[model samples]
Target chain A: MTALASLTNHQVRLAQRLVGAPTRDNWSFTTEPVQEPAEGGVLVKTLALSLDPAMRGWMNEGKSYIPPVGIGEVMRAGGIGRVVASKNPAFAVGDTVSGGLGVQEYLLIPQDQINRNGLFRIDLRAGSLTQWLNVLGMPGMTGYFGLMDVGQPKPGETVVISGAAGAVGQTVGQIARIKGCRVVGIAGGQAKCDWVVKELGFDACIDYKAGDVKAGLKEHCPKGVDVYFDNVGGEILDAVLARLARGARIIICGAISQYNNTTPVQGPKNYLSLLVNRARMEGIVVFDYADRYPVAVAEMAGYLKDGRMKSREDVVAGGVAAFPEALAKLFTGENFGKLVLQVASE
Target chain B: MTALASLTNHQVRLAQRLVGAPTRDNWSFTTEPVQEPAEGGVLVKTLALSLDPAMRGWMNEGKSYIPPVGIGEVMRAGGIGRVVASKNPAFAVGDTVSGGLGVQEYLLIPQDQINRNGLFRIDLRAGSLTQWLNVLGMPGMTGYFGLMDVGQPKPGETVVISGAAGAVGQTVGQIARIKGCRVVGIAGGQAKCDWVVKELGFDACIDYKAGDVKAGLKEHCPKGVDVYFDNVGGEILDAVLARLARGARIIICGAISQYNNTTPVQGPKNYLSLLVNRARMEGIVVFDYADRYPVAVAEMAGYLKDGRMKSREDVVAGGVAAFPEALAKLFTGENFGKLVLQVASE
Candidate 1:
């Protein structure tokens, strides 16, 4: 983490604007000298990278939560790191922190943006450094609030979740179980589905890719789905819409399946059921409830401590170069649970 | 008032089913002699008939709130009448009542069906009989609860309503005003626009036929709309969706513009904004809140008495023969307010 090593930093940059779906060729890895920390900045060596499905939406040339990474800029992502150098009073040398370090070996983060928003004190002993980006990080917070605050899971209510064994999905199912709801997960295959029911204690798991989801869901959820926590939106969403119980609520946490879609996203054809059953379908962004993060984090952490909440980390090794492939795991459903890229040695 | 009109009579039969839209040609205005009331049955002499846009949806060959009016039976509607005779011990002759008496001069209502649901009993002296069918009735209850419960208006928020000068729209805007919100209305013409702003005290009004609604809305509600009480749907909905503030709520009371469409209801093109803004759009059936009607009616009545609320009745003077044309007025927005047919004298 010396000046000499930082000078040879190789960073991945957006080589060309994606006309349609992004391919591996769109990124360029080049070595460049990392500059010294400015008056109110800190130089950090990337230790871990958080690969999120939201990165795809950020790459698209349209309005979203955040703007698209410019053609020659470093790919935007969250990364856990150690402050190798600093000009700020709060962050000193060797302080373990998280920030928007991008797809790079080193980052010069501004002082003002280095607090609770992105950069947080890391506890390596709690689980693993990767777990910070998984169980205790953005995906965990998303699952916690999206289910607890928005899904409003009541005891004995049948809760169905799409992308059930993935990052946010894994935590969502466990949380629902903790709240005394009959949690049913919709995952991809026998292996992942088995893990959800066995490891996560979900009441049932549907291999959405293996059989007819609508029929499978109906068979499992005889009372009908009271809360549908949707992540992967498409035909699966349409299937869930059909089986919604009276006063059901569909929570649109994320739509990973439709994010990389080349064409426009299709509306759920069976939305009229919202009228028939007097149900509601609502979209939510995590940032809207940022103020309540500590409340959600504390509750989720308590479950994590008592073995009530199970955590899964689909960790991809080989540092920042591993980010792009790790992110792709979400769309392809390749990763088993929370997808995170190990950037540097502990 | 005895059994002279015998056999609990005077029913209008639906002679034919509607092929596309129900017109005069699709109906036969024939009457049958009244049938005698069975034990615990109350005979109602129909006074005022409520004509609603939902009647058109009922005529279509699909599932809705109530079954399609049978080809050989009387058309269903909410009506206020005088209970000329009742066999049930709880009811006596000359008790003013309101119930689904079908579109006819006289109806032999079952005491269990009417009395069990508490469908009858009205104090005519408190408000005009027509007002019960307007502001103090279903339309008023719909506008009141649909906005307050679903829309959840906050003080200083801006509310924009489509079909703004119509029965529900006018009431919704007035209620938003009562909640300390700025209100803007959308109607079809200059006259309706003038009535909404000048008479109803809506802060601003937009004539959809006169200018660009999206632009007009931007100019008027500079802060962006928080609650959209939509009665007329389609393009106006799209325009409203584009200008919604963050965390806005859309109350789908009724979609008058798209009711008669032979094709499927197309999803809004700008619906992604809901995800972007983290907003909610909910469809409501007033009957879902039937238990709370008396509470809503009493509050709305208070508003009516205090001069904070006014009911506008577009009374088409005629008997059951005027039913076809009176129903058509809703689709064309020809009826300025609550469209009612004066079926008989009180």
Candidate 2:
């Protein structure tokens, strides 16, 4: 058990409110003696951490789907871990779990915090620890429901997605392909674009960092975008809005591009296209579909088993202190797939 | 008919393409001898001309629901008239008709242009000539289907509408009230706001020109906006978006405020609220629901007959020569209720 009696916890806490893109100055790294678990509490040893764009939004002080992380508090994160010690009957030693485990070496989930924080056991036989945080986790569930329900992509229809190399975007493109759609992906850099097309089986991938998005969309989607699954909103969102086919469905999953903006978020100026084409733009939060996760997991597991879907995790070798730099990789387009920080080896 | 044998037509023609708002210099007034209707054609004397915000869009060169008005051509408009002469079996000399009669005193609709231009007989017993151009015409049809089909307001829910004093807004607010929704209207001035609430029976009206719209929405719709029928768009659309309830519906009928903007259209900055609240924003064109107009008109007529609804038309006394000046009144917010120019007394 790695001598839990002498364990010391290393944590990254919010030191200052971020103004724009997060820097090292915005965080504080500290070490403290590990506290004993309270009665009925469970202590989890962090194995891996998920680095996401949503973490940027959680750093800002404003109204969002969830509350902002306050200064001096541990930064919130989604991760996989092994229960090292447990005083609760619901959990036991050596049981693997996944939840909002914060960016820390060890997460001591007091009894009262377990339910609200969503701690649950995961089967290692189903997938690797990194895959659970990728395709079988939040990103996977987000793409499954958002594309199938909100996008409603019909067979033979054209589906274009922004941020196609990111975790959610990768899942969305592959799922749309399985649903019999002509999937086009918009990603940064030539490598990411090639990976999405060659590896993920997308029809075409637009390298937005290299050329014009409007021109690329015209060349690839001659029939126009019937469904646009947007993850990186901003000018890209406006560009897609301009090319919407009649009755197009735009699913607003996230706006990673605007998350680090010092100025006001740039809204899509071409939204009037919705009126001209009789289209709709809607938004979705994955947490809203928590009850249906099992159904999506089962379907995705089948796709994985049959080699119809592929999942990739870019695992950065570092402990808990690597969170800030790992998160920066998302905005810089350096992360090629689902980015995960290895807090410790299994 | 008053001296039909010696009838001369006064017409307003587009002299130059408008850059932003239409100035008098952009139009030319001319007089010409009325031409005889061709074989299977119908000649009509204009009774009342409907002045609309959509005229601004038609002046610009672009693809829309209809084609743009060409230079030196008569300005497009919808009006009620008496069929003075006809060669087709579908119409008689005394038949009262409604169609795109243009900004002219007399309209000679040739055979081939009849169906495409929408020449149809209207019952005088159902409404006054001005009322037909207001409550029983395009604006009413827009409000009926847009609010019912797109907005889909449930009883006791809050429905907020922009451009509350305009032709479509007044109808939308009243219909929402009839559907048992708590209706709030946003207009430019106190007088127009008062008329919407006191005359049209809207639950509340916010004078957008006088104060903050966000504060007004908070004061009126404490439960958050369930349906937002956006006619003005721009900042008002953003304000209403910030107050959307879970599963809210935003019906984008028009963007009157942005129609004349010299700058690019301002998209709703708070559109992410749609994601936070799991809401939808959709666009509707009234022309799409042409086949269902009869059902809407019958139901609206019943509301008028029982005194459950009221119709108001701000009739400006002038012929086609006043077309430019009358349209200017709409952008200036100088006209109250549905602005209709009286080409001639009925």
Candidate 3:
């Protein structure tokens, strides 16, 4: 503990703003000696980090829901960590914490940045560290609020989700199913599709890579989709838009499919279907619903305990060095579940 | 009056479903002898018909908000008419009415079809015949509900409207202004642009033909657009989307620009702006608001009488014979304001 300042902390920093998809060369790996926390501050050692599709948007230099990750800065990420040292009475050493820990081996959060970083202790008894980074992390909050608030699924209504095997998609599907809504998933592969249905308890899963999405939607959602949770926006959005029941709700969560395009995103040409059906398309950011996260966390944690819900994380090991490849897997659909970078062993 | 049954009712019927924009060959001129009213029915003489962008959608072969106009059927339309004779106690011979009058000189509403056609007495003392076809008709109902309900503009917020001088656009801008929002309009030509700003009291009007709409919106709406009434879709819709304020509301009314496209409609490429700004995009079909039309009509009628609202109709003469040309003017952006087919003089 006396030699904490001598511990070298490794990090992956943005080398430049991304043009299309981020590559290895887009980031630079560096290391800096750790520093002791000043008065009323905390030092956290990263254990695991959640790699999300939204990170692709953060690499782009533009106005967005949040500020862009600037060049020469450590890439922003949400993760589970342990307090290595604490100078504040509110937190103590060895407490398991969750926060915007960045793609780094360690994070030094000043007293003023405590609230800004959204640092909080995680109850490991409820879920493991990987589970915390999966269904109990930022993605969980996003899917919870986006579906429960924006999607507003009523029991017996049909809810279709794109990227249904991914982080937010998994949570959205399980929650909708729990709410007694018919859950249909759209995933890139048959394995993913099968998993969402056979494992996650989705009513049906459409293998978008192997089959026609429009035809599958028509087959599964005979009455038309009442709530569509769109993660991969583009053709799938149009497909769902064309099959919406009157007064359907579409939750715009993320668009991994369009995030890496060099050209502009292909907007849903069938958007006028919203008019024909008198429907709505709304955007949801998890950060906005931060205040009510405890209520959601408590409810989902119960689901995890009772076996009514499950979570999977495609944990890629190699610490901070694996982040570049880990983030890239999101766009290629290579990662089978929540892509989490395992920064260190628990 | 006894010769009413002998009078020839000049009509325009759909020759075939249109491939893109309707042309002269797409319609056929026909005539039929006017029939006497059956029991519980009324006969109406068409005074003026509203030519709208939604008509283009009605001509296509598919399911829409309303069923497609069948081949060889009279082109469906809404018009201001006068009852020439009536057997129903609900209507008198001299009553002015508004309903789906079709592209014909006279319509004989049978006993069961009166409610289906939406025939209702129109108060001419509130607005003239052309005004009834423009601001007091379907377009007015569309603009009123779309702007007020879907837009939900707050006081001092910025509202950007496309097709500024058109029937729906004019009504939307005036109402947004009346609601104390800063109004900006996107129009086609200089004349229309000048009229929206100088006459209709919009803060600024963008001439899409002469200038860049994105830049114009940036200049006029320094605080960003809070409410957008999209009449002309395509590029103009994208422009307003690019300048959305946080929590903005977009009302999807009509896409006049894409209605006649031989190619697929170009979707708004900047639609992700909805996500970045935490805004919403909702579509409103005026038919959905029919139960509340009387409330909207009464409010807008008061605005017209008090001079807080104004209307302009570019009435094309030669009755139903000029239907094809008048309808074409909408796609070509030739009409100055509301394009109305003047079937006869009241």
Candidate 4:
């Protein structure tokens, strides 16, 4: 394929509305010849696309941090790309960049949408292309702010993380450990639990699928859970709620476990423990901390540089056609870390 | 009565564990005379008592912010009284103050249990005896901080209070209105609705039993609800959840509706709207703002004195015998404002 094909050609559009969980039938891939960029617009060739649990929330028809990806519209995704062509004064051909460029080999987006207050730019050496969408990106920022700002970990405090082996949960436990907290991670299996305690330096790890979570928490958090960073909100969150100490804080970064739920989401049965313990539980979106991204990025990158922080990416290589299956991996817990789609070759 | 008689006074004990909603038979009141006070104890004559919804949660055998009142123990109630006699240097005979002396007419309590921090002297001019148990007491403090600190209302923003015209709800709406918010109230009937809107100056009031709350909200708050100070939980709270503006906040001060629920408390079905609209629903206990009590009391009192803030107390006269019936008023929405029991005559 010519560079022009990579720049302004292949695309995927929402073929139909999803009935329940998304499937391959919901998307349709197509190809078009290169098109010239209009003034104030730049053409981007997507290289890597981030697959987040939030993608499920985005596909459904409802309100969220943003509106759903419309039927017959290019399926929306965040990606790293190269500016293969440009008519915007701020950008030129061949500048590496990132933005919500859709599931397409090429995109011509307006400068303002592309800029978004300078959140996206070309930075090849800042981190790996996949890393930019992982630890140095949304999941990293989610962990840093959700823990440091919302959870407010203090040294010697017990920090518990549900979905402990997943991308955001893994980073949350590590950050809690770095903050001098005694981190306890709750994942779904022995392997995930072992990785959390052995590789992530968590003081304890509970395999929630194998054992009774409430009992596990009782044995592990003898002092009680002071800060609970929750990613999977279901029975595990309920278990954590029961273990909260007086004045504990629960930071809800995401609730992946119940995302594809057909009916209304069910909350922890023991939430009133907040009143009984004089504790606080807050739901957070990472965009709320946008102004503090530079601070988080610098701190997280330092840990990565020093080998104190590690990130794993399950990269699926294909064109835009791989989006649906890769997104499903998050809910199944099949993606051990950040999931990304390699959309095009440089 | 002799000191020995007062010290061994008959105490109301939990007769049996409540299976679901508590009944009068669940409590048994027995009387005995007091014994002599310890070296640093005071003999108190319980003059006024505060019945709080939290007392219901405390009655259940479970862990909470404070411990359960315990089986066969005096039921926990905050009372204002005179130190009829004292052996403690910090208190003198006839000193008027408030203490957690349980639901008894007289008691010999160690000074540390009541006066560990310092004696909280009541200002007779603040209103009257029962007002201390209402407007200038726990419920008052709860309303003040939950709105200002937790709800964080902004001028002209819509503030909707559930259980409006109840103790905490009435104060929250009034305070939010005073803070320049366009206030809306949710209550059980037209009378309460009229009282809140016409007398209390709330922009509008919805009687949950009389109308569709969601439709009423859409009609009243064109801009959407910015602060929902929830005292009543369940469906009313769920209705409010659907109409939240972006960045709206739900301050969970109390859930009186769910306190007696036999099944586990069901979370608001629409809570996912918090993530969608970038809003937050948080649980807050008023005691967390203890350090700011003087600040709240001073402002509320000034409002009370200047005819800006209204303190409506629904007082039922009698001694400890009135406690059970008075507590029921909160659940029935029978009492218009703060529910207080007169434990003794002046």
- Top candidate by DockQ: 3
Which DockQ values do the candidates obtain, in the order shown? 0.43, 0.80, 0.84, 0.49
List per-prediction Cα lDDT, in the order shown.
0.81, 0.91, 0.91, 0.80
Ranking by TM-score: 3, 2, 4, 1
TM-score of 3: 0.99
Candidate 4 retains true contacts at a fraction of 0.42
Best by TM-score: 3
Return the TM-score for each candidate structure.
0.91, 0.96, 0.99, 0.92
CAPRI rating of model 1: acceptable
- Which 10-residue window in model 3 chain B sums to the lowest lDDT? B129-138
Candidate 1 vs candidate 4, TM-score winner: 4
Give the Å shift of residue A73 in candidate 4.
0.4
Judged by whole-model lDDT over C-alpha atoms, candidate 4 comes out at 0.80
Candidate achieving higher TM-score, 1 or 3: 3
**Which parts of model 2 are misplaced by more than 4 Å?**
A35-39, B1-5
TM-scores of chain A across candidates: 0.94, 0.98, 0.99, 0.93
Q: Report the alpha-carbon TM-score of model 1 versus the true structure.
A: 0.91
User: Candidate 1 vs candidate 2: which has greater lDDT?
Assistant: 2
Candidate closer to the true structure by TM-score (higher is better), 2 or 4: 2
Tens digits of per-residue lDDT, candidate 2, B195-281, equal 999988999999999999999999999999999999888999999999999999999888988998999999888888988888999
Models sorted by DockQ, best on top: 3, 2, 4, 1
Instruction: For candidate 3, write residues A98-150 as lDDT tens digits.
Output: 99999999999999999999999989998888888877888899999999988
